[model samples]
Target: MLSTGGSALIAKKLGEGKEREAREDFSFLTLVSFLFGIAILLIGNIFIEPIVRALGSTDALLPYCVDYLSVSLLLAPAAMLQMMFQTFFVTAGKPLIGLMLTISGGVANMILDYLFMGPFNMGISGAALATGIGELIPAVIGLFYFLFTRHSLYLTKPVVRFQVLKESCFNGSSEMVTNLSTAVVTYLFNITMLKFLGEPGVAAITIVLYGQFLFNALYMGFSMGVAPVISYNHGSQNLPLLKRIFKICIGFISISSILITIMALVSSPVIVEIFTPIGSATYDIAKTGFFLFSINYIFAGINIYSSSMFTAFSDGKVSALISFVRTFVLIVLNILLLPYLIGVNGVWLAVPAAEFMTLFLSVYLFYKKRDVYHYL
Candidate 1:
């Protein structure tokens, strides 16, 4: 929450002091930032296991998690880089470049996934490599165009401002925190599920959890699109526009939640087939569990984006509190309560239960902050 919202806030700043502060010309800076994304994601891919190992919980469950996590983190740096640069471009009135960079990279990633997953015999590592290389491609292209071709909005040079870097980090820290929360929760779930459900159970949870990520990405995208609008309007003191944007964002959230739920349930067998085709019944069961897990999307969408809305306005405490409700407190309750309630199903039901509770939590938080946010 804090990282994501803060990044949006930082985007708000690009419209301020940009010309003089753009120590590097727009082209060079874009290139540098693009490089930064590739570097960061690569770091995440290479270091993820070591970071997990540093926590000192090397159960049998650890190995499997390391493989799945490595693949996703392969693209995380590029994703985060997008967050930072998107703010930069949007503020400069060149949002289209950022959007094109993201969409193109994502499409390329899918193509690479297919190529490496089979014909290249890279297996999991191949998938990771494909995603990582795919992510860097458009970043290269975007940087090339920015540096060699297009006119940047306000940037002038590629000078280092420790302050700008710090601000960018600070602004985007909420996303870091939110994702870190995910990593922690995943760790806890893996360990705990292993204790009760065993390795197969843990694997099942993983497949379902990946489905969760897809749903999360959609909602997060909505937040991403809305963040700039919120930041720009609030900065311009256009409260009415900001409020309208927020309302429309909620609509997006709702629509996504509903669509994700329907799709997951209706397509459960097909979705399951993606990871577990025929040989492994355990994998199939895991996919079934994944289908069950998608039930939480609607509530999750409401709770998460509302938290983001708070952070965009620079209310870090509120943002943190809201995140705590969904990520920490609700999860903890599920961890403690669910296993006792319904056995294996209890474990599967835990997420939806947590999301259900967080929906109310989000509304309450919104109410408490209504006065502060009423102008928007």
Candidate 2:
């Protein structure tokens, strides 16, 4: 919420030729994000056990959770800064640098994971430490860049502005809601799967979710990548350019959605095999569910883009409404009702049903906002 919200505000200021205001907003948001990170670190560490338990962690999982979160929470500050810089990089016209930093951090994390877990025998703690260190890489570099470098969007002496903070939170609420709702929905799915098919079902659903994350990441990245452009154009009232950008986004998402769906369908067997041995019970369950789940991709891109686009345009209320409905309301309803209605297939089909229905809402919003945003 902080990152995208602040970035959108900065983009608008920049479009209006108010560089100093943009810098002020950036600095203020950076300070707020840092403080928020610190709070998370302190609170998470103090309440780690209860938090894990609340997430439905079992007795057997408690120790591993402790070991992991004990190390991981230390990186809360770094994680927060890394996320903020990702969007700020695009706003500053340094997106490629951010991407390079992220890639480097990821590669470093993988290497560290192998060394710590395999060679040092550190187990889950090693994995957590590796991830924290990996996150720190980009976070540290981003801090240095914004603090010391002469850039279009660099931090300055922050002037406390409650109004700015409020606007940022409001504008970015959809992102926050999306994340929160994802956790809740995952828990619901796990419980539902456990009820229907036991541990194997939980494992199967997890594998399918992993695949969903892999595929949906592309849409998320695309939406984020274009957000600054949308904000800038909207701020400048460049209707022609905004229309062009919107068309391009829609076109790109449409073609990519189909391609990604096909790719997921074709690779379902291989993906399931990677997670579980072929002909195993879990493998069969995952493969079947994955095939049905892949159908969501066709509609997911549009829904995601719709919410993100609204956020970029600073219509946080609409953005949050779209996200809440798509991710939470419909998902909970479908997950609860579908399984009772159609047995095991209902669990597998819940997400697709929710996403497909959300498409209508997305399309309606696009049509309704056409005149206001001039992006139709």
lDDT of 1: 0.66
| Model 2 segments more than 4 A misplaced | none
Worst 10 residues of 1 by lDDT: 20-29
* Regions more than 4 Å wrong, model 1: 1-7, 14-83, 86-96, 145-171
Across 9-72, the per-residue lDDT of candidate 1 in tens digits comes to 4445543444444424333434455576577667867787787676434566467557756766
Scored by CA lDDT, what does every candidate get?
A: 0.66, 0.92
TM-scores for the candidates? 0.80, 0.97
**Tell me, what's the RMSD of every candidate?**
4.2, 1.3
Best by TM-score: 2
